[model samples]
Target: MTRYKIGVVGCGFFGSSLARELAAHPRFELAMLCDRDFERAKDVAAEFSATPTDDHDAVAADPELALVVVATPNHAHAEPAIAALEHGKAVFVEKPLAVELVDAQNMIASADASGSPLMVGHIMRMMPGVRRLADLLASGELGEVAAIETSRSRWIDTDGADPQWWKLDKSRTGGELTHEIHELDLMCWLGGEVTAVSSIATADDGFRNTVVSFAGGAIGRHTISTRSHTSSWELTVDAAEGSVHADFHTGRVSRLRGGRVEESWPIFDVDAENQSLIDSASRTQKYNSGNGGSSLWMQAAIRHEIDEMAAVLDGKADSGSPLTYARERALVVAEQVRLGGGEPAALSGSAK
Candidate 1:
């Protein structure tokens, strides 16, 4: 088995967790850990027996690093990812692609130019329950997917691993839409390409809702809330023949056809635990409000993603690569979000 050398930028919660997981995985060699905080990088690097540095450029320059995984903050994903690709390394970055459309496009362009395998980290699409849901839809069991509704909430605390300020600050993080873009990607993944989006966001109150119109006349409605102490996540899809309900955090997926329960399954191997939709760095990606954490299933999904990417890089066929799929759709969603649903013209891909 070929073990890919990996460099992870950002020593924050998600980054550290991914670095740890990569180090333990048999297919990966945790080569470098980079963050602005050299001390934090050192601590995490020590755990994995990997090199630690405060300089991101060092990782990009490392000839031994075959992969670069960018788990930086919502606004900071672009630079490391783009630079890594330019350096001839396969790159994976956690979602929202980038806070700005131009940056996202540049990242996509870089990947295209570099001829390196690029995949947007829309982790939920790989969830077991979501994978089953995708299976049902593809098999025509759910019939034609007409509409999808998804809702999620995570109560964030200022003292939490991720401070409240960074989560809510629209100026730095692109506000609530940063989170919603993931949902938007699911919409496109399940419902099809998002032809247009009619959305609204309240940064101060921390609420957002969007009515998306798919290319083929399908419809999708999504709600993302980072406020409130109660954390919950559920996505219900209605089709012509049946409907499917998915609990992202707990991994519960069910199907109802003709007013009867046709089938149901857990995203994880066991129904013994519940999962939430929100994977917060605050809880170290745990959904304690529901499941213990983001569930070991998510870790499996990441592993699968890494393995597939490694194969693709090694001349294997890769399908359904959302290299720019999620990012492009996310750019449209981000534009609408930053505009506060201002005008129909704001729906255009251009960002202010």
Candidate 2:
């Protein structure tokens, strides 16, 4: 039984969570933890008896590390990822792939030339309910998708450390449109290729609405904002057969027929503890167990991806997430260039 040595770069919020997940992974062990913040890196590294280093080059340069998870901030994704791929290590990059078009393409090219597997972490694709929704869409139970729409809105106090400020610069996070590229990838998977998209963004607030045209003639409309007082995440897909609406937080699903709600899936009841996949079709969800109250649902999605990556390494399966996630990132960058002249929300009382 051979185990893959996994190194995690950038042990911040998501990075630390991924470190914990990788440490517990059966086939992969957390070999190293890296962060410019030395103390934080040491804290997470202790969990798995992994060594901690501040040197990004050391993590990439290690041939013993079979996989490196690039959980760095958005702007930081490209370098460590490309370096690891170049060193012949498989790479797992946290979502929004990269903040810039050229960086995204270069990451993909580096992986291609190195023959190391590249996977983008789109947490939504890991959700049980979302995967079920995708299943129904592809099952033809929904017939041809006529339209697909989604909304993601959240409000932060912005008074404390103000992490939103990390994302305030489009260079660091890629404005709201680019930030929602995961949803866009889901849109492409559920419907088809998005042949064209026209979007309008509000002032510096990060509110955006985009009208999407699909190659299959199906349409998509998206409204995404990080400025709202009320938080939400909902998605609905309409098709010739029926429609399915999902509440991302609860994993509640609803079936619609004749433009009226036919039934609401008791996903919460089925997954009483708010765990497990309500729909049985989810092979990914069915096998994975709990994380001991660490984080539910979305965290489960991350573990699912980790396991899939292990399978890819074992030659039991092909790559996990599609390369199109990388391509769509390029497309988002192009669209943002056309729709731009917008700036990220300014950090309060900071130097202008």
Candidate 3:
């Protein structure tokens, strides 16, 4: 198998983790690491046995780099992504895609113009439990999904945070856009497209909550709060026949149907290898969190993205464009929250 050359921008937690994972994949060549903090970049570069530079343009200009992973802070996604695309590199960008709707549009438009594969990191769809739930819904095993409820909350101690915090800056991180867009995308992926949204966001208390109506006549409610005492991530789907629950943190799936309940944990299975790769890819692509079972599964997805891009470069694979659509829906939800008054306007796509 031919290895794809990769450049990584940003040396933060998520970026460094991805760089390390990519470096371990024989199918990928870690070509360069870029960050404004030169020292940080050098450290991550050393881990991957790659060059480190403070210059974004140098990474973008590398002829050997076929893919660039943009894991910078929320505000900085667009420029490097656009630059990489213009320099003929496919890109995998960390989520919210961009902090602003206009920037997200620009990135999408640039990807369209460049004819390069673009993928956003909406990792929930990649989780094994979530994927199993989605598969159940698709198979009619859940007997028609009626609604989806998702919750994510974590305590925030300002005293423990660095002075240069980016998450608190609404303009940069887009708060819920950064934190809960994963749920929004997963809801869309599991239920259907969101037709309209009505939301109430609390800026003073570090909380965001929204109710969304999907085109498939399903309703979704999301709660994202940073003031909670403990972090909780959960997704539940209630249907006519029964309900499915996914604990994102533990990768557990529980199903209740016809007065009987069943539960399962994601296990390593060679027979389910391809599906496992898709599930793992979705997780790393979105969450950047290591897989609970084996890091190899998550690494496989990262390598898969690189391989897919290499395939696109070699005219052997179709561009994975669903990710762009997912990015668009995430932006719509962000805009709804930003509007913050009266009912949200009708979403672009049909619900059913």
User: Using TM-score as the measure, which candidate wins?
Assistant: 1
**For residues 62-118, what per-residue lDDT tens digits would candidate 1 score against the true structure?**
999888989888788888888899999888887767788778778877887888766
**RMSD of candidate 2 to true structure, Å:** 8.3
Candidate 3 residue 138 C-alpha distance from true site, Å = 3.1
Off by over 4 Å in 2: 162-165, 180-182, 260-294, 319-334, 337-352
lDDT tens readout by residue for model 3, 1-352: 6778889998887787778777876777888999999998898788778999998889889998888989888889999999999987888887767887678778877887887767777755554455567777879866867899888776644554444566556666776545457776776667666677777766574676778877778988888776766666778889998988776555456787765676665522333543554454333222223223445555554444444445555656433333444565756766777776334444432121
Clash count list over all predictions: 7, 0, 8
Error of 2 at 298 (Å): 3.5
Model 3 ranges off by over 4 Å: 140-143, 267-325, 341-352
lDDT tens digits by residue: candidate 2, 1-352: 6799989999877888888777888888888999988998899888889999998889999979998998887889999999999999888888877777667777878877898777778766766566666767768977888998877766533344344556546667775566556666566456655456667777775677767776688987777775766656678898998999987555588889987888776433336434443322122221122123434544576777787677767766543244223334334423544555232222111110
Query: Candidate 3: which pairs clash?
Result: 121-285, 121-286, 122-286, 123-286, 126-282, 215-351, 215-352, 216-351
- lDDT of residue 8 for candidate 1: 95
Flag clash pairs in model 1.
Answer: 249-275, 249-276, 250-274, 250-275, 250-276, 286-293, 287-293
Give the TM-scores of the predictions, in the order they appear: 0.83, 0.81, 0.80
